[model samples]
Target chain A: MNDETLSAVDVRDAVKRYGDFTALKTISLSIKDNEFFTLLGPSGCGKTTLLRMIAGFEDVTEGAIFLYGDEIENLPPHQRPVNTVFQNYALFPQMTILDNVAFGVEMRGNSKAEARRRAGEMLELVQLSQFSSRKPSQLSGGQQQRVALARALAPEPKVLLLDEPLSALDLKLRKAMQLELKHLQRETGITFIFVTHDQEEALTMSDRIAVMSAGELQQLGAPTDIYERPHNMFVADFIGETNLLEVSVDKIAQGRATCHLGGGHELTCNQVDDIGVGAKVHMSIRPERLFMSDIPAEAESLKGTVKENIFAGTDITTIVALAEGPDFIVRTSNSDRGNKRIFEPGTEMYVNMEMGAGRLLVD
Target chain B: MAGGAASGGSATTDTYKDARGWLLMPAWSVLLVLSLAPVFMMLVYSFLTKEFRGGVIWEFSLAAYDQFFFDRGLFGDDPPVIEWTYLTIFWRSIWQAGAATILSLLIGFPTAYYIATRPENVRPVWLFLITIPYWVNLLIRTVSMKFLLRDQGPLNDLLMSTGLISEPIHIINTNLAVQLGLFYSYLPFMVLPIYAAVERYNFALSEAAADLYANKWVTLRRVLLPAVKPGVVAGCILVFVPSLGAFLAPDLLGGAKNFMIGSLIEEQFKGNAGNWPFGAAASMVLLTMVLIILLICARQQSKAGKEV
Candidate 1:
């Protein structure tokens, strides 16, 4: 990496174990300065555990963690230059909003007046200065979340760790605060390591996402890279909705693997490494990537019967069952002109997957 | 039609509320009769004069109050002098109770914290163990302390055998002994409420405080202490009020040196003092003080509740 890409937090072979259970396997990743990095996974996939390790709330059982190139594994939580927005916001219930925001600054040995001034600035940043005198319970969930963010930022820590801060809000409020949080992160230029099990939230806000499963990192890359070019079965399936079709590899040429979808229908996918001819693999194709057509197009296509047609508000999800293969789903956007044709069940349709849309998962 | 329906709905709600209130009257009356009636009786007795033998004269008099404040003149020429004996006893009772409350808190908080931090599966077991003291009668427990602390008791014998002390020390009839007894008796009250608070506490707040660069002590002050304040205050009140008027501990542990308000009332009513009116008067004073403390606590709890 270049000097400009110096790591704000470099987690090296970090492992967390609770007695006989290993919550996080040896995991290594470097979060860049001022980057919005998200640890996205299902619950118990160790995303929160890794975030806690970086926040110094958890001990690294067997590896090191460096913050700004300084080894911080042995440091106590108070000594680390990192803060966490807890899952529940965890605002001091006894204190006013102003006092809650001022707490971190005061803890850093600032005078009460000085801390109040900075805390006021943070509250203003979060657009909560008007509610400074109110207690945390007086505010709504979104308001409390902003206060938590402001409070964590008041100390000006190098890294900010958010543990599902928006999970408590309703869907609409969560969507709105997602953008606000992204904008705040950009304005403050703080490296954010956000943890969430919500993949859509991760895809919406994260600059890069580290997808994890079963205590191991499945993939670490930009959102589009993880979404469009997932490295394995877990990464492909976990990050978004996908249809995993079992296929047999027939040949390899020019970085593409020719695979036989059952019933002699041939399809070629951009091949991942370590799979040779005659190997069984699952071809991961996103539901949105499959195109439905009345007539077979020039690309590789399979004839299947329409199993179910689901009319969602924004998209039409058509599930198709191949004559010799498992069922697959194709999602197409709804058009305003209202001239789109809908295929009923038992109708014969050609399912076309564009070249490079499918990833061969050998795992 | 909407207005009429709305009025009818509200009328039904009003009748329902009235019925609920009427149903609660029996319980309220029971509380008034069982709890307040004795206090009201004591208030009446406090104003009456002591009879020649033992009963009250029913004639309203300030003799009890006068006896509390003034010393009788042994000679005809000398005027009644202001005495500090009863006042000293009263003040001593307050401070000793305060000390016991503080001590109980000091001991209870850590025990509660330890129990709270234990794994969820074992928490109920620890709580059960803490409450095991309640299963034994407090008198037996207090008397057991006498056996453990007497000069030739097991504690002193063990200390002497370990070469920690050369001679047996006297600790049975001192104010310290009374405090120990009170502390032992009321510690559960302190622990249970603090444990309840700690059990409900979101430890994430402490972690957030620490993550904000607060050291351990600062985290305790800013996060843990304030979060558990209601429980601490409750524990203090529970320990303080009863310790202030403690009769058994002072009687059994302190012998005669310690005379709290409880013992003073006991002395006036049935001991050699044999002054029923004076005992009632002292009981009234103690009740007033306790009521004031209770009011302050109620106000504090309400304020804390609102803040939360």
Candidate 2:
């Protein structure tokens, strides 16, 4: 393939405007072949709108989308070579499960025998062949979801768009289907564009994540890169729980900043950009990265009093009040053995950080 | 004492179920007086001997049925012949009712769809417009329709002035005018049920079909029409049953020339040949045809319901 067709989907400066209000401001992204890409954000953040535009349900208001070097922005939804597993499944209530899956194949000019044969194979792939003759209302939600997946995959489109397919499932079923969906994508080797509002699902299933907010892309990278090195405050705060501390830079050297916290506590953390010396900025550190320790570990430690400890199943969380800076939270694995290391309330302790644990968020 | 009071309350609640049989008394009386009694009277009177003017003699006879199937002659003595007059009238009534139902379905489906797809606040206004004409009496509406369809009416005047037609066509006393009156009278029945069904439909199913390579017409045929079929059937029944026995449309609009079943039954009693038994017999046959149609519809619906 040539360079232009190397990527499965290439979106350039795509903008979606609903009347006077802009839903997506000039956004651009590239999805590679066989890659599981996720668009993650809260509701009304334009993630679903972008997915619909790719599926041709929404028109391209400004920019172009190229699929395999072909501009398909003007194509109607039925003419586009893409399919979507809708959020509500949207299975035809009047059709049998087998007929629902065969509908796409028959509409694409296949014979009845051929369509039914191919539909059978797709239903087998989704492990729902036993429900071939049943209506959609007769099946359970999970079974109906599988039927929807089979129907969308029957056409074997170039890209499969999933709009929160597992949002309607229970917690345990959702956890199970997450793995199933990831395995299905890998098995089929089709480019999958999944849209979801769940941060955890995005982190667990997607090879790369695009975090969006307020009609714009906040950050786009691999899950680890997005989690460990957020580009701004919004991405860091939106992705997961993080404690953003107020600190003033004293000096910058070797891509790290020596900053000062209150109560004469000094620390060195990785800096995202050169903000110059003595400038006040916010730095983010994960709660799991900080731990209670006895060693007064030189320049990467802070002194605080233990305020509370909450034991939550597998992990114990401790809230500590620093001498002058914001209160800090520390999480540690729980154990059954008795030990004196766990501190009670009003006990003064030193909180130590691992190397390269905290990074500066530049906005 | 507290336990005794609680038991008393429980006993009162339990006795409510036993007293529930009285709740159906009004319905039972309504069925007996309003429906079953009339039908039973017609069935008995159909087989009785006809008197001279407008009453029946209390004697069991097949003369009414014999008058229907084997017309002796205009006089008293002749070989019996197969009666084509009454049979032709029934067939005409059936054909006209079927055409009116089909016409209403064609126009009603699209109108209901348009009203359903509008914004929620404007939908009631459109429905009000559709039903406003029906608020007038049916007799007045039929008379007004006759005036509009006459040769010198505004419809012909507008058509002649527009040069679409060089002459005023006679329509007021035709079968076409009768069908027009029936369609106008019962169009709301067709539109309302379909509108309700379309309103309850999930549009995401249409979107899903479009996503899976089905265009607009294909989506409507395969997905939408099948889902709203119950409503369509209901609308057809509502329009067809009443149209089968309508007298006003065929009388005022059709000029009393061709006798529909409604007019035929009416002529037996109110016209110069006042045969009450014959009228009652015709009513029984019409009732039987309607019962058969409703039974067929019920069977179709039950069969459809079992698939789901």
Candidate 3:
């Protein structure tokens, strides 16, 4: 029996520093074998640094990294079982695609013939077998990206790190590559650690994601958990669109709290931690969960005036302004809008939502 | 009211434009005149007959050109014989310069690479050190090398004191000494061009090569070398051209047996063997040789740059 735990990459309390600047704070995570893990963050949020560290380009100042259950923290990049596809897709400009792909294997003491044969196979895997003799400069952005990916995978690394590999392409191409990469990861069954600032890309391709901010890991969870149940305001605002309304707790009884809005609307929501009656808190409701009504609903509804209306594809988004708080937005299907009629500017509208749809967060 | 139209008339405008164009004629003529005068004078001197009084008489003759190719060294076989000395010196100068250039490129490349990879705040300081020796006179630097290499100098003293040698070595006044001086004098020139080239290096390419399974040496040989060839070639040309024409280092540090073309040309202008016409002919030949080399280097650089 192999008896290995089967997690492809394991990082424990990883930290990186450059003189006085700490580029990566203490981070710990375990990526399951063949799992598509993503590090999502804004620029300079240590996503690229962490990726470099995994690829052996950057040394971990304080941490242990394990690959296939073997400690690889002190290993040099060329000795590590991980390969990185850089953001710029750093394909060797002078060499043809075949030589570029064969380079890693050639370094590993493989004969030229064997390396070329394996490189040819990898090019076929990436659907670019015909471009073997073409230089990287001759290829398009997407083609170059695939070549970079093929080059990294030619060595059959245990983990492949992609540092914003799809960012250089056009929007349409980026979307296509994202899907292609996901399929490629599944086909190869190698753990892929993708780093990007694009939330949509992370949510679409990752099995799990680690969201970082200012060199610190904010939250690490599955994509749905990160989007639907973000731990803090940063994650909530970062992952998707949300409407945060400042409200005061009117009363609390049996795992339920009554929130009083400034616009004279009262609502009952599921109980959140560390809240008392008359204490201020922020209520978060996703735009898709809010609905419009002619009259306020019984349990969780608020009154406001329609400030703006947008006809988005497949949905209508209405921005409603309460008398005392900021503007609130609600998105509903255009078909649903036909029944209740989305209001125009200056029209008084009652916003309705399920009590379970609203989440209260302490200030 | 009619004065505005009269001033803007065709003749007035035509003269106004012509005046601006004509104004630059003298400056342009002066530049052309200044650049062509020495070349024309040198060509005239090359064909003139030499007078015993150390002057040339323009009698329209090729005697000086003929004599320059047949001239002998101050000390050689057959009492300053003609055959083999001139051709031998010509080939030796090129051979020495080429070797020194290759050595300089080898040493300067990695130094430049390291400096280029340094942090922005420290890069300037490292570059400053490379350029500091250049501020001193080249002759002074060449002369100082003798002190560091002479029989009683610290290098020999240390080697002998450490029992690594029984007698002081004969390093100073040898072909090796000339090469050492050539390499040192031209090292900074080589380094700067390479540093400029390497400063633009993208680590992405090496990482890409690594992912493709290239080990360190393979990456350097296949990817990095081609990427930095322009700088390497540029440095080679920078070092080789000047080293070819170097006179002081060979005179001060090299043995009397060592002779470069520059010293040969200089000897004609000085000593009892002063022959200005022969020297002028030789100088013209030397100038042509340098021009040919420079043209070739320029072509090679353009080709390398286009590849990148």
Regions of model 1 farther than 4 Å from truth: A1-5, A335-346, B1-22, B72-80, B162-164, B271-273, B300-308
* C-alpha RMSD of candidate 2: 3.0
> For residues B1-308, what per-residue lDDT tens digits would candidate 2 score against the true structure?
99999999999988997888888889999999999998999999999999987889999977777777667743457767878778788999998889999999999999999999999999999999998998899999999998899899989999999999999999987888888888998999999999999999999899999999999999999999998998999999999999999888998898766457888888777955789899999888898999999999999899988864
The C-alpha stretches of model 3 lying farther than 4 A from their native spots are: A1-4, A127-131, A247-257, A261-264, A271-280, B1-44, B60-82, B158-167, B284-308
| Residue-wise C-alpha lDDT for candidate 1, range A1-363, written one tens digit per residue | 446667999999988999999999999999999999999999999999999988888889999998888899999999998888999999999899999999999988999999999999999999999999999999998999999999999999899999999999999999999999999999999999999999999999999999999899999999999999888888888888998888899999899999987677788888778888999988899988788778997887889999998989998898999998788888887873154346789999898887788888858
Error of 1 at B61 (Å): 2.4
lDDT tens digits by residue: candidate 1, B1-308: 99999999999999999899889999999999999998899888888999855679979988877777678743336787876788788888998899899999999999999999999999999989888988998889999988888999998899999999999878899988889989998998999999999999999888988998889898898789988888898899989999999888888888887878888888777744478888888888888889998998899788877753
**Each candidate: RMSD to true structure?**
2.9, 3.0, 5.0
Cα deviation at A342, candidate 1, in Å, is: 5.3
- Ranked candidates, highest DockQ first: 1, 2, 3
Indicate the residue-level lDDT of B270 in model 2: 94
Instruction: Write model 3 residue lDDT over A207-236, tens digit each, in one string.
Output: 999999999888899998888777666788
Q: Considering summed lDDT, which 10 consecutive residues are worst modelled in model 1 chain B?
A: B68-77
> Candidate 3 chain B, which ten residues in sequence have the lowest lDDT sum?
B72-81
